[model samples]
Target: MAANAPFTPPLALASLSGEADADWARAGAAYAGAAFLGGIALDADSRAAARELVARDRSEFLPDEPITFIDRELAALGDVPIQPAFNVRSATVEPVAEAARVCRDRDTLLEINAHCRQDELCAVGCGETLLRDRERLATYVERAAETGVTVGAKVRAEVPGVDLPVLARDLEAAGAAFVHVDAMDSEPVIADVADATDLFVIANNGVRDTETVREYVEYGADAVSVGRPSDNPTVLERVRAAVDREFGLEATR
Candidate 1:
């Protein structure tokens, strides 16, 4: 499998799911960096799993309408040339492969969602539950890689007993192009994972400014990602400026 293209600005808009609609995608594309088009559950089974969790907790925002195909859900982004990636969740390889194919056809990146911690998603053996089954997670990555699209896996770093670097290595062995890590509060894990695998590392979590962005890059992240703060143009610009200044790269925005 071919390695995915590197993220342009060394900065990305982390996946935010339901809130990452067409407008959000447009907003992200307007910036001078990579944009991860939120997490989209691959099929009915995956959507149901998310819905069950959302029903129990009204705060969780899942798609109110059903999204049957990954491409169909992402179609609203249209033909924008920005570096766009799609985050997906599934309990089995079939859906992952299917979504990966869509990404391949659309010329985008497909990221496996192994970072979500929803109770219902975990109960159904999806999301962060996949972290517990490294072998299965590898299988999922392998299946997605077969599509010839860039395959990335987004994983949480704080899961108890789960070695983040080891998991990253497993993904590399399975042919993933990059590992998107929600490092939580552990900046060291970013360096560790980068050291453990050859795959590109995109660091997520607690990045509110240039200092944090520079900190992650210093920790060995090929790219640093921002989520909630990306909704604000001013914050996004500040963070983007930091990346530009520290990395000596120009912003596309």
Candidate 2:
């Protein structure tokens, strides 16, 4: 939500929790220059709930320890503040509030994972399921905001029947600090979302280099994020240089 800063760094390292923990320490060091970094998305509820999600989708994985352990893993990133995204399967706001409190205590941001498409998560009315239930999602955001930590909602742009721009507006109205959109091949959606809300708009998906970074900026995104490509330092450097040259933005490193 630091959009007021002149020349905000256009590139950020997106969430890579499940697949990258083994290399997380090294990977975090490699992309330390990123303007923003997101920790792996985790289930913010009980282990039994996490296991149920995993059982439904073999690809879904959550840490075995308490959610606070995520704080320790993220601390390994050192100076690069991490916004830890969490997927909660609860019908109430207590879990969301607890996650937000953790982030607040850690002096970092908390992002609600409404962008994930895992089957098990969807079945439990979590993840993309929130997309269809905008009111409920807004309540969750509102609850998270009560913790006094910056709360962001991550959403996919391509979900059927859900208007991305309107959703962004609703989230902002609900006290969300920003809306992270997985633009997913549609740069204009970023434009629409940016136009609809005053909240910081973070563009995600298919970002590979400077051109893509500039493209999203031109489309009105406050910032752009890189996922898999951030695993390689050389690639991250190229994108960072591009952002600096194209937007006159300096890396915060």
Best by lDDT: 1
Q: Estimate each model's TM-score.
A: 0.91, 0.83
Off by over 4 Å in 2: 1-8, 20-26, 29-61, 78-92, 250-253
Cα TM-score of candidate 1? 0.91
CA RMSD per model (angstroms): 2.7, 3.5
| Number of the top TM-score candidate | 1
What is the lDDT for 44 in model 2? 46
Kindly report which residue stretches of model 1 are placed more than 4 angstroms away from their true locations once superposed.
1-5, 57-69, 250-253
lDDT of 2 by residue, 1-253 (tens): 3355212344566665345442443454444323233333344443444476557654334555435655664466445433334333344567678767876776656778787676655776777889999999999899989889788777898789999988888898898877778988777998888888888887888877777888888888777777777677787777777767666756444
Worst 10 residues of 1 by lDDT: 58-67
lDDT of candidate 1 over 105-169, digit per residue (tens): 87778889898897777877888999989999999999989889889899998899899889988
Model 2's alpha-carbon lDDT is 0.66
lDDT of each: 0.79, 0.66
